[model samples]
Structures are given as C-alpha cells and as structure tokens.
Target: MSYDPRRPGEDKSQRAQTRERDDAQVEKAHRPDALILHEIIRREGEEEMRRTALALSLSGFSAGLTMGFSLIVPGVLKGHLPHEPWADLIVSMGYSIGFLIVVLGRQQLFTENTVTPILPLLTERTSGAFLRVVRLWSIVLVANIVATIVIASVLAHTDAFKPEVREAFAEISRHTIEDPFWTTVIKAVFAGWLIALMVWILPATGSAAPFIIILMTWLVSMCGLAHIVAGSVDAYYLVATGEIDLAKYVTGFFVPTLLGNVVGGVTLVSVLNFGQVAPDMEGQDRVGV
Candidate 1:
C-alpha cells in the first residue's frame, strides 16, 4: 500500500496523528536526564541533612534491624533447600528481602547515606553542609551498627529460630570473617559501589524500584559482596557466637569494610556522578533554572 500523493488531505491528517503519537511516546519514555537526577538526589541530601539526630537514629536503627532479615531469610532458605550447589542461587534471592524492606520503607541506611548526603555536600561545598553530612553519616552509621549488634546477638543467643536455621546462620556468617583484610575490603568496595549505584538509580526507577533494589542486592549476595551493614549482621553474629572475638571482628571485618564502603560509595558513585552533572548544573544555576 503506497501513499497516494493525490489525496493530500488524508495524508496530512494521518501524518499529524502519527506525529502526535510519536511525541507522546517520546515523552513517556523520557527518563529523567542526568541533571534532573542530580537535582533530585541533591534535594534528597538536603532533606536528610535536615533530620534531627533522634529521627535519624531511630530510622537508622530500624534500617539496621530490618537488614538482619537478609541473614534470616537466606538462612531459612539454606536450611530448607536441597544441598546442591545450585541451591545457593535460590538462597541468594532471600538476601534481597531485607533490602526490599529497607528501600521501600524509606529507612535510613548507611550505605545509602554514602551517596545521598554526598550529593548536597558536593553541590553546597560549605563547611556547614560538610559538617551536616559528617554528622548524618556518623549518627546513622553508629545507629546502624548498634542495631546490627542487637539483632545479631539475639539471633545468636536466643532460641527464637530452629536449630537448623541457627546452624545455617552460622554456616553463612562464617564467610564474612574468613577473608583476609585486603580481600574483605575489596569485596566491600564492590558491595558499596553497587549499593550506591542502586541508590542513584532509585529516583529514576519509578514503579520498578522494588525490582531494581532486589536485583542489585541479590547480585551483591550471590557474588558474596561484603556490605558493611548486612555483613555487620554476619560479622557480629560470629562475634556473638564466639566464633570470632570483638577484636577480630573490628580489625578484620569492621575497619576494612567500612573504609572500603566509604571509598567505593563516595568516590565511585557520588563524586563521579556529581562530576558528570556539575557543568550542566552550573549552567542551570546561571540561567536561573
């Protein structure tokens, strides 16, 4: 069916409708560009910085407590699944459960702070903004760690779970402290990078947010990435059970993972993304956008 040039009126009408539909489709598919994403995250940072210490602590503690489900779910799966190696793939899906809860629930997570607060700090470039970021990070991290300690101890010392599940927790948690210092740090860097990237992506995900969170977190789990908060659950579990002492947990897992997470989340995600959008943002500033 070829176009009939003689029927100009019909052709014009069809062409106009086609153009309208195409324009609508383009608008629908337009994800927020980098500059828009930067502004969104920067505003999120500002909001976070405004939170009172008590608010941040309570939220962070909830996040940390919720993160323990990453351990519980997988331990449950590992207990129920057949002993085949492929079973780990199934178990890994459970690892995303805690992340799904935390992300969707808007809990204050520490790794998320590594990127979110950094955005405003980069934009503001003031001592006060920097101090707020430091304050937020400090309070959130400590609160998260404290919550992890509480949960891990409960998982360790309580008879809350069945023997198999407890044993599964032990089996799973031992790996966190098994790695050498540098190795754990390297793993943590990847974990932090992925988690931060997930944070950056969330603003753009819209209805797919849960899927993205689960996918990224599951990858971290499947690859055995050493996330500071999630791994803290594991590390502290080991500590609680007397499998590893406090000194060992501190020197081996805590210090290195924390350092790596900061480096990975701040340097790899926040700094790089801010650098990418800074010029455009400055242009927006000049133009009063």
Candidate 2:
C-alpha cells in the first residue's frame, strides 16, 4: 500500500506540529512586499486628500512652528562651537532634530504633502482630484509660511534666545539669502527630492523611520540645499532683522525654492515612482496594513 500522509489515525502530535509549521509559513508569506508598501502609502495619501481643509491647515501650522527647532538647534550648536570647516557637519546633524519631531508627530508638512497628495491625483486622474491636491497644497503652504513669519518675528523682536544664539540665527539667515537665485532653485530641488523620497521609503522602514527622516534631512542641511518651509523661516528672519528686504526675500528665495521643490517632489519623485508601479497597481482594490 502506498503511504498517505493524511491517512486516518495519523499520529495526533505529528499532525499538530505539521499544522503549526504550515501556519507559520502562511504568516511569513503574507508579509508586505515593495509593491504592497507602495499601495499602502498610496492609500494613506488618498486618505489625507479626503481630510478637511481646517484639519490640514492646523497640522501644517503646527509643523511650521515646530520646524523652527531645525534652525534653533543648529544655531545653538554653531554658537557654542568654534568656527571651523568641520563645524558645519556637526551643526547639520542638529538640523535633523526638527524633522524628527515634525514627522514623528504626524504633522502636515508642506514638503511631505507634495508627494502624498500627488499619489491620490495620479490614481484618480479627475479634475476634482487635481483641484483637491491644489487646495491642500495652497492651504498647507500658506499656513506653514504664516507660522514661520510669526516665529521669526518673535525671535527677532524679543530676547527669546541668548545673544550668541540670536547672532547665530542671523548669521544662518544671512548665508541663506546670500545664495544666488538659480543656486537656491537647484538646491531646493535636491531638498524636495530627498524629502519626497523620505516619504516613499517611510512605509517600509518600520521602527527605523526616525533614523531615516533624520538622515535624509541632515543630508539636505549638510549639502546647503534650500527647503521651502525651513528656508522660509530663514528668509523671514532676515526680513525681521532688516538684513534683507521683504521683496528680495520673496522674489529671490521664496519663489524659486517653492517652484523647485514642487518640481522635484511632484515630477521627479511622485511621477517616476507612480509610473514604475502603475502597470502593477490596476487590479488591487484596497491596500493597507
């Protein structure tokens, strides 16, 4: 007679063991893959698109207010350290502090929205969806800028920080505005690309999410890339201190950085990633955790 594994009266202990092993294997097979991660983040983006305007505005304002630490921490560091070539590297690491808090806190940062909202529009491809993306962008960007302006004014007018730290802030702002227009644009592109890539990789990072955010943002700072939200604080601080005129700040830094960031996040990161997975995403109905 041929041996049959499922024969009647099979050893009970052996059957139980076999079942347990099969269950473990099944669970392992269900772990998320790269495509699944893409779907997961895409779903998240769609949900964010559906949030109320007020909700987005509040979160964005909070993010902008909180991101001041990116400058503050670095300014403090630069204040304490003696001026040297390598001091910038150490100061750049301080730049990561604000990003960690903002991202981990789940606030609506405008840079992050660049990639997140684009995903929903890509999948839906409707005029309404396109408009919604624009609405979210406009609200978040304005809210963030307003918050930055408020914070910069307070820092400039009041003794919010020590003299050394305040001077450091002015020095940082001076360097930021001193960059040529095209240089700011190009650097902002790199910043935007990196920030969007951070969003894309976040779903797959699991517990290491904070480290990734810090690393990418630190790279942005170290490379002297312009970032709209963070750079807004720098620009506004210059205006507050009378170091640079409002018109120059807006026309020279804000406009180019904003355009460059949008191009980098939407065109380079969002569009390219969507194209890579669009062919495979057709049949999936819902993707989530």
Candidate 3:
C-alpha cells in the first residue's frame, strides 16, 4: 500500500492551514489580465453612452428649462444686491442648481458622457456600435438644443418672467454673442473638463458625491466657463428674443461649444482613465485565462 499522506488519528489542522495559505498566495499573485480591463471599459463605455444619450436628451431639455433659473436667479439676486456689482456673481451661483440636480440624481447631461462612451467604439471591432453611438448622440444633442430654444423663446415672449429678469437673460445672451467663436470654444472645453472631472471623482466618493458636484459646478459657473447644454439656455434666449440670429447662435456658440466639450471630456478624462490602467496590463497574454 502507498504511504498514507495523513497519519491516522492526526488532527489534520496543519494540512488544512497549508492548503489555505497556498490558496491565499495564489489569489494575491493573480493580477487582472489586460484584456479584462479593456473589455470592461469598452462595455461600460458603450452601455453608458447609449443610456447616457437618452438620459442626456431628457436631462438636457430639463436642464434647458431649469437653467433658465441661472438667468433668473442672478437677476433676481441682483435686485436684492442692487448696489453691488459682485451681486452678479452671487446670482450666477444659482445657475448651478439645475446641474447639481441632474448630475447627482444620475441624469445624463451629454457633455460629460461624451468622453465615457466613445472609448469602446474606438478600440473595438463591434459592428454598428460606432454608428449607433453617433446616431444616438446626434439625436439627443439636437433635440436638447431645440427644446432649449423653444422653451426659452416662449418664456422670453410671455410675461411669465419679470422685466428685469428678462433683461438679465438678454444681457447674458448679449455677452455670449460678443465673444468670438473660438473664445466660446475654449470656455466650453474648460467647462467640459471640469464636468468630466466631477463625474470621475463622484464615482469614487460614495456619500459625499453631492457635495463634490455642487462644489465643482459652482466653480465652473463662477469661472464663467461655458457649457454646451447650459449655455444653450442663454443662447436660446437670445435667439428667442431676436437679439441674435439663429445662424450665428448655432455656428458661433452651439457648434463650437459642443466640439470643445467633446474634446475636453474624451481627450482629457477618458484617455487619462485608459492610461492609468494600461501599465498594469503589459505582457499578459490574451488568453481565455
């Protein structure tokens, strides 16, 4: 008979302990293979992109209407701070209200999600995925802009808003129009970057996400950075009141801002995320392993 590996009447506790240690060591040495991280990011990007597009379309419309508060609040506050120029800044803080709601509540806001969903398509061979992502983005973005224009126009024409408040809205629009197209793009890029940063950081913070969002957006607004969706509120108001022509608003502000925002989110945040995980994945053979 072969020699027994275990002694009769022995507790076998040491053997159990040795086996556990071996298992623990194996687990500790196991690193995630590169392809897994790539696939995960890819799937996350595509799914998020599609879902985010829909969410953004709806959220953008709401943001458009809600962002009207940005225009209204500053002017409203200005009335109270009647004597101080700094009051203008104070009221702008109110503009962040809609953003905080949309971001924290998990509604897609367009610009931020632009970066996240494109990565998979960029790296994958999935058929129609790229087209679908683009199609969704185009649909949602156009709808959002149109909704903002219509809503802002209606509000501007009606007595629903007080005269000074309307004037403030118009004033904001005029200021935007005064900027060069390139300048607007630059501002939008900065805004998009900040928004993406907010998104990336929020996921890491469980309970304090809301506070982070509020703080980042407040800074975005206070810095006068232009956001494509949010800026549409001001732009639409301008177009609605005939203060700026439709062509100029579209070409000058909307298009450039959209491009800038895309660049900021995709080129900056998404790439950074990809880079962070790339180094840890080298030399791992792409096996079913």
> Which has the greatest lDDT?
1
Better of 2 and 3 by TM-score: 2
TM-scores, all models, native as reference:
0.92, 0.89, 0.76
Task: Give Cα distance to truth, residue 16, candidate 1, Å.
Answer: 9.1
Give the better candidate number (1 or 2) by lDDT.
Answer: 1
Weakest 10 consecutive residues of candidate 3 by summed lDDT: 280-289
lDDT per residue, candidate 2, 13-123, as tens digits? 887777778788987667566576667777888888788989989999999998888888999999999999999899999988988999999998989988888988888
Off by over 4 Å in 2: 1-31, 283-289
**On residues 128-242, what C-alpha lDDT tens digit does candidate 3 reach at each position?**
8777767666766776677667767776788876777677667766655667888888888888888877766554556787778778887877888888877787787888787
Q: Report the lDDT of model 1 for residue 118.
A: 97
Q: What lDDT is obtained when candidate 1 is compared to the true structure?
A: 0.92
- Runs in model 3 with CA error above 4 Å? 1-44, 49-60, 122-127, 281-289
Model 1 clashing-pair count = 0
Q: What is the C-alpha lDDT of each candidate?
A: 0.92, 0.87, 0.70
- lDDT by residue (54-93, candidate 1, tens digit) is 9999999999999999999999999988899999998999
